[model samples]
Target: MTRSYDEWKAAAAAMEFDGRPVIGGVRVAARSGETIAKTNPATGEVVSQIHACGQEDVDAAVAAARAAYEAGEWSRAGAGFRRERLLAFAGLIEEHADELALFDSLDMGKPVREAAAIDAPGSAALYRFYGEAIEKAEDLIPVTPPGSTALVTREALGVVAVIVAWNYPLEIATWKLAPALAAGNSVVVKPPVEASHSTLLLAELAIRAGIPAGVLNVVTGRGSAVGRSLALHEDVDMLAFTGSTEVAKQLQQYAGQSNMKRLALEAGGKSSNLIFADCDDLRLAAQKAAFGSFYNQGEVCSANSRIFVERSVYPEFLELYAEAARAYAPGDPLDPETGIGALVSEAHADTVWATIERARRDGTIAAGGTRPEINGSRAFIEPTIVTDVPADHEVHTREIFGPVAVVAPFDSEDEAVARANETPYGLAASLWTGSLARAHRVSQRLVAGTVSVNTVDALGFTTPFGGFKQSGFGRDLSVHALENYTDYKTTWMQWG
Candidate 1:
């Protein structure tokens, strides 16, 4: 099921965005008249060009969102009414799965199958789950003592600025958008300039799904321009972002300088995958670990990049893991058979290569340390696994954010826990062990927001996902996300 270049091109051309990007039911371009060319990272080919948003565009979008929120037609409407609209939106996303998947593949270099199966389906499920969850949300618990009355209600926090990263643009955008909109907040989305096409299209779908005008706005531009404006805009009530820790810091400063908007940042991670010798399923663990790190060209923030194997089975585990890594070769993203694809951009691929080089200079290369050949001039990199990397190596500590895994041997469970928690990040970790007691002990010790026992990336829409420490705070994609976009109002009244 390998799709040819012509097929991919045809698909991309046929994919429509329901006219132009929507803002308050109006089709509008950038007021500045500037534009950015959307290039396919896999082939360095220009897919399309979008009007580059400037400060004026940001203001307009925010004004639209603010007006929507103030009008209370969407946010202040009955929860049941909001629920119906969100359900319709989810249905629309499911109906347009092919177009959304194709656009994501072309814009982000992810395999079409993966995008269609995992990313797009996951997004639809998120909206559906949150939509249903919000309907059941009510003030059931009273805050008054004895018979005294105090009502606890959840109020929308007005306009939200959701700034998503380029790695998994549509997926992460839906992660923020689903819950925010379900909680009844008008959204001003600032998608990464590198991959804004699909996001803009999603905004169109929202409009078609009967989302009130101005409830969801899409602004496309560089982070310095539109992103900064959204974060600093006084009308913006909250900011939900997913990207690097450095950028998250800058966003925090922006939020502070502005109106102290609520900030939900899901940032960088240097996660570890621990494989104990007692695990009966070394083969399964090896496969999951390899895919967990190398999937999405290692663009995942919660990738299990640092692997710690028990000394007893270290050699055999490395062999199996390397074999699994080789199974995921770089291929054309449009091909359904392709398990792994390009690295988003040539510049990003170069950065990944440089990081691998740095690791090799400081540590022993285990398996892949070279680039793979591609049919087109795309940003493709071979999946790599390195061993004998010191704990202090930058590759082990920092977020390489590419298809590279650094394996290190550990003798005991305590050592594995220590190694896992050595980095500034506490995003996610994975443990593979057969013993229940050992699983409980290790999971408790791991200083990460999400820990997978005998699993890799089993992320679901119902679970609260976020990070701790420098990985950034706040949650997304669940009831926790609903709370992030809402403010609690406690009303106290004295009986006359």
Candidate 2:
């Protein structure tokens, strides 16, 4: 059953941690005893206090991960044992799905239903999928002439530092941790300070599921401190991050300056949604595009923020799209029925409003460019759609990271393809066309990592997800993600 906003808020306030951060099977406070407040975006209230991790805390977390990796506690464990433990973890997540969903909603301002149905379920599926993959993964195979042989093996990269973004905190963490753990790497998770409660709670759940201490560690602090320290830590063997493109660049620089650790980043996107003249279902296309760009208050990195419509259907498409946008109601995240929740915080919401105002000063506002009213003193922006934005406008090129989309008109297939690939980011794109040949051609020309031919933002667990160019390199889900956390070793031997 879904709880009311007041009930959810009350439950969150009543929830409490044991007054210490979980590290190496022990609950201990930071030596400095500082704490960071976790705020509820829906109400602008402090939901909980997380450890204010510093350089020393980061060092301790890294040491714990290093020790676990060096001892072969996670990496050297047999595939069957790892699989069993991971499956158990997945089950635990499912068992506590309600609490986890509530925590995520309260902490991150994502809709409760989505947190329960999509984010949490997707995370659990990742663990279960990786667990199964580990069981079937093959060991070293010999290849050579009859007299000589070579062995190819995969080894875990020790001490992975997983830095997750505030949006989809728990889901992103699982995307990095599940595969890394399954592939035998210890992980030190640095969750965004804005939404660290769910991640910290997940770490506790890991302990309950029998995961060894130090195999997983949670450090909460601002990116400049804890996050920067982890990126530059010498003991960290790999860095898996999902955030903005600018931060990813900084992380790359830090890694280069440090131990040159392996870097896997899934960064920002100015994803496009194309509606061809031949599309038979204009309403469906409009609905999908609306949700793709506006869902999660448009906080998704892979949001379809750019919409290109064929000139023939442009007029009709705009009408339908506007209706769909109006249907999305922005309200408190704790309201399970709310379609659109608050932005992550007041500062973020102000930035989004400022971006809209800037866009208006530079161009014309086609649709919503205002804030919505809510009972709580938190950040909440309406679903906005802008037209007449030039191709070079900041709104078109930059990642607004809000429920704001820009619509542009295209004369032909070639023009649509060109406009779609014009942005600096190439993370994901969607095409709406009835012709199979056009779909194939346009998808090939569009320079994104994931393309949905008839849909928008339809990413699956088995498929690899990442981006090209400035969107950052390295895949995030499936076997590809596992390979990113491990290094391949080849051995050649000759006998008399």
Candidate 2 clashing pairs, residues 3+ apart or interchain: none
lDDT of 2 by residue, 77-124 (tens): 988888888999999888877678877787878888788777887788
Give the C-alpha miss distance for residue 94 in model 2, angstroms.
0.9
TM-score, cand. 2: 0.97
| Backbone clash count for every predicted candidate, in the order shown | 1, 0
The lDDT per prediction is 0.86, 0.86
User: Each candidate's TM vs. the true structure?
Assistant: 0.96, 0.97
Worst 10 residues of 1 by lDDT: 13-22
Return the lDDT, model 2, position 465. Answer: 95
